[model samples]
Every structure is written in structure tokens, then in C-alpha cells.
Target: MNLVLWIFTGLLATALLVSTVKAFLPREKIAATGPAAEWILDFSPGALRTIAGLEFLAAIGLILPAALDIAPILVPITATCVALLFVGATTVRLRRGERKTAVGDLVYLAIAIFIAIGRFGPWAFTS
Candidate 1:
């Protein structure tokens, strides 16, 4: 279980950090962002950047607390928040007629939820 957590932490963190960096980069640097990223471009730059920043923070939240053994309860809370973010992402993707992207969001949402449940219950860390 610990190994699984570490895996998820690394994957999720890398993904989120990359996304955050991409969001801040110039439009030309992101010439081939997928349909979802293109859709995000439709919104204000601030909005897009905010989402990216939140994701980056959530990624850190997924790992830092548990890794440091300080306020480890935050792991579950962060996972729950990430799941909620993906729920919103899924909704937006569906609304944009992006079935594949929406499905991807659903997958992420599931993983985040799983982490939340596991960290909160069966795999909870001890003080």
C-alpha cells in the first residue's frame, strides 16, 4: 500500500506540475495541447492559470503531509479536493462534447477518490 501511494504521488505530482508549467507558458509553446487544454484556453488566462495552480498544489498535498508525517490527515483531504476538481473537469469536458477527455477525467476522479478513501480508512497513517 505504501508503494502504491508513492506511485500515485509521483505520477500525480509530475502530471500536475507539468500542467501548471504548461499553463503559464506562452500560447505558442503549447501548440499541441489536447482538446481539453484547448478548451481551457477559451477561458481567461487567470482562470486557466488558477486551475493549473490548484492542481499543482493538490499534487503536493497528496504527498507532502504523509511523507513528512505531519498532519497526514491532509492526504485524504487533498485527494478529495483533487477528485472534486476532476468532477468539474469531467462536467466541462462533457459539455464540450469531449467524450474521451471526459472519460479521462472520470478515471482520474476515480483514482483520486480511491486515494482519499484509502488514506482516510484502511491505509491511514499513524501519528
Candidate 2:
């Protein structure tokens, strides 16, 4: 179960890191990438960067403390924050009528929630 949670955490962190790349790009460049990126057009570059910064932090938070055994408890806390982030993402997509994107956001949310639950429950690191 711990291994499973680690795998999930690694994958989520990778996804967040990938997304962060686009966040550093110009908003126009991101929006021009494809239909999937069109949502960036609705946000200012600063807002997008802020979201990306959170994602970067979440990615690090999901792995570092736990991996280092310094404060594994932070893993679940970060996962919870990541879940909330996706909840907001889903809400925004739904409000914009981007049903397709909203579905993707919900999937990420579920994954984040799963990580949070697992880390906070049976798979949690002790002391």
C-alpha cells in the first residue's frame, strides 16, 4: 500500500511539473498550444504563474518530506491541498462550460483525494 501511494505521488508530481512548464510560458503561447490550453486565456499571466507556483510546491510537498523521512505527515497535508486545488480547477472549468476539461480536473481531484486518504490512513509513516 505504501508503494502504491509512492507511485501515485510520483506520477502526480510529474504531472504537476509538466504543467508548470507551460505556466512559465507566455499566456498567449499557452493558449495557442491547443484547445486544451484555451483556458489560460481566461486568466492573467500572474494568476497562471501563481497557480503554477502552487503546483510546483505541491509536487515537492508530495514527495520531499516523506521521502527524506523528516516529516512524512506533510505528505497528506500537501495531498489535501492538491485535492482542493483540483476542486477549484474543476469548478472553474465547469463554470466556463468546458465539460471536457472539467472531467479531467475531476480525475486529478480524485487521485489527489486518494493520496490524501491513503497517506492519512493505513499507509501513513510513523514518527
Candidate 3:
């Protein structure tokens, strides 16, 4: 279970890092990408950047403490935050009638929630 959690954590963190980079692009550039990126137009550039910054932090938080075995409780806490962020993302997608994209957001949310539960429960590193 621990290994599985680590695998998922790494994958999620990598994905967030990629997303953070993309989010940092110019708003016009992001919005012009394609249908998958159309949602970028809904948010102000600053807000988009802020969201990206949080995701980057979350990615780091998910990995560093656990890997270092120092303040490892942060892994679950960060996972919770990631889940919350996905909840908001899913809400936005739904509100925009982007059901297809919303499903992807839900998948991320589920993964985050699973990590949070595992880390906070029997598979906890802090245990």
C-alpha cells in the first residue's frame, strides 16, 4: 500500500507540475490552444496563475515531506488540499456545462482523496 501510494503521489505530482507550467503561459496563448483549453478564457490571468501556483505547491508538498520522512503528516494534509482544489475545478467545469472535462477533474479528485485517506489511515507514514 505504501508503494502504491508513492506511485500515485509521484504521478499526481508530475501531472500537477506539467499543469503548472502550462498555466504559466500567456492567457491568450493558453486560450488559443484548443477546445480542451477553452476554460482558460473563463478566468483572469492572475487567478489562473494563483491556481497554478497552488498546484505547484501541492505537488511539492505531496512528495517532499513524505520522501524526506520529516513532517510526513504534510503528505495527507497536502492531499486533502489537492482534493479540495479538484472539487472546485470540477464545480467550475460543471457550471460551464463542460461535462466531459468535469469527469477528468473528478478522477483527479478521487485520486487525491484516496491518497489522503491512505496516508491518514492504516498506510500512514507517520504511524
- Each candidate: what lDDT? 0.80, 0.89, 0.90
Using TM-score, rank the candidates from best to worst. Answer: 2, 3, 1
In order, what is each prediction's RMSD in angstroms?
1.8, 0.9, 1.1
Candidate 1 lDDT over 7-122, as tens digits, reads 87677666667778756676544645655566655567788778888988998898889889999999999989989998898888888888977887887788888888888888
lDDT of 3: 0.90
Residue-by-residue lDDT tens digits, candidate 2, 1-127:
8888889899999888888975767888878888878888888878888999999999999999987999989999999999999999988888888898788888889889999999999878898
Provide the TM-score for each candidate, comma-separated.
0.88, 0.95, 0.95
| lDDT at position 13, candidate 1 | 68
User: Between which residue pairs do clashes occur in model 2?
Assistant: none
Q: Once model 3 is optimally superposed onto the true structure by TM-score, how far is the C-alpha of residue 101 displaced, in angstroms? A: 1.1
Residue 101 lDDT, candidate 1, scale 0-100: 73
Model 3 regions lying over 4 Å from their true place: none
Clashing pairs in 1: none
